[model samples]
Target: MSLGLAGVCLALVTAAGATSGSVVFVPVLSFTLAWTHSIEKVRWEEDYVVRPGKTPGAAPVLEAVAARVRGSGAGMEPPPDARLRHGWYEYTPTLRHPAELRLTRSGFTADYDWCTGGRCRSMAGLLPSNGGVTVLTACRSAPP
Candidate 1:
């Protein structure tokens, strides 16, 4: 039984019968469509679930994220103000900048000032799903 990702989806679609089959097909198809996007260099899987107000990024998967960050964007370029605190990483792009990207074990936050005028404002939003990306390659066949 070659039950790979697509195979598993097909089996589910078949089991759903004709009436609600379209519903199942749509979501499975979306997963297939994910191939179009860039695969991040590193991967984070089986992320830990921390309680509200607790810090994130303490999972072992975070080691991969940290390693990927080191060699990335290397050069004479200035390094961002990066802090690993309470299991979350906060990166301020520059000094006195009204912007920061914070990645916790649970998710990420982007806060910044839109403008300096009297109407200037700041904004942030919580993530719907905190799961970080996991890069999947084509699974290889078992040795014959």
Candidate 2:
């Protein structure tokens, strides 16, 4: 009877583990406007000229944003079939010329690339304008 009881307990533990493991955690993408220097003098249709690579302290900014995102209960586990590794984006704005910079997880991953630049086609094509700093996160979708 003791042996049978032991076996039952083991089975119960195993079943519990399996059930917990099957629970899928979706990845959440987040973005923030590190800094924005307005060019109030720009004329023509261009309301404001956007230049990347200008933030003085970007490392800490990115780290803080990442921490906030993680703390928001967003699953940190990389997608099972995720081609690209999880990473962050660093947008650098300059006076003469600025460019949007991204440090993405290498490979053909499919999470979400948060950006203020035209890097992420999904976001670049459709971003609201207000001349202020902002944070953006990608929403998760089922594997294609």
Candidate 3:
């Protein structure tokens, strides 16, 4: 079954790999000004994160979606910080349990280190097309 946009993986289908043939685009925030909190701090921010699986190599597709989402906001005035970002968006490969990755942009980037207990290392960095996810499982990496 489809989990819709459960957590950050968005609409990850119940299959893994780029070969799965059932790739799906998870939910993306169309509007900005969302609230976020963490040990670091809490505040409202403008950003959108696309939840893509961790199979790797899904960045291109996710980026395309992000462009569309950003495009929707075009013809209007950009926020003060829009100049610094490509599209106020990023792709989340996976969201660890209990250690939730909230709606904060920093949270997404920091989770890379926190979720891995600092031992987590990405050889190629956060791309997209992660291990397929189903209703039974959020986007999960094969347990080591």
TM-score of each: 0.15, 0.16, 0.19
**What is the lDDT for 19 in model 2?**
18
Report how far residue 43 has shifted in candidate 2, in Å.
38
Better of 1 and 2 by lDDT: 2
Encode model 3's per-residue lDDT on 91-126: one tens digit a residue. Answer: 322222222222212324332111122233331133
Alpha carbon deviation, residue 26, candidate 1 (Å): 24
Task: Give the CA lDDT, 0 to 100, for residue 12 in model 2.
Answer: 10
Model 1 C-alpha lDDT per residue in residues 15-51, reported as the tens digit of each score: 2222222111111111111010123332111111111
Say what the RMSD of model 3 is. 15.2
Better of 1 and 3 by TM-score: 3
RMSD of each: 18.8, 22.0, 15.2
User: Which of candidates 2 and 3 reaches a greater lDDT?
Assistant: 3
Ranking by lDDT: 3, 2, 1
Candidate 3 TM-score over all chains jointly: 0.19
User: In candidate 2, which residue ranges exceed 4 Å CA deviation?
Assistant: 1-67, 72-102, 115-144
Residue 118, model 1, lDDT? 32
Q: In candidate 3, how many Å is residue 121 off?
A: 38
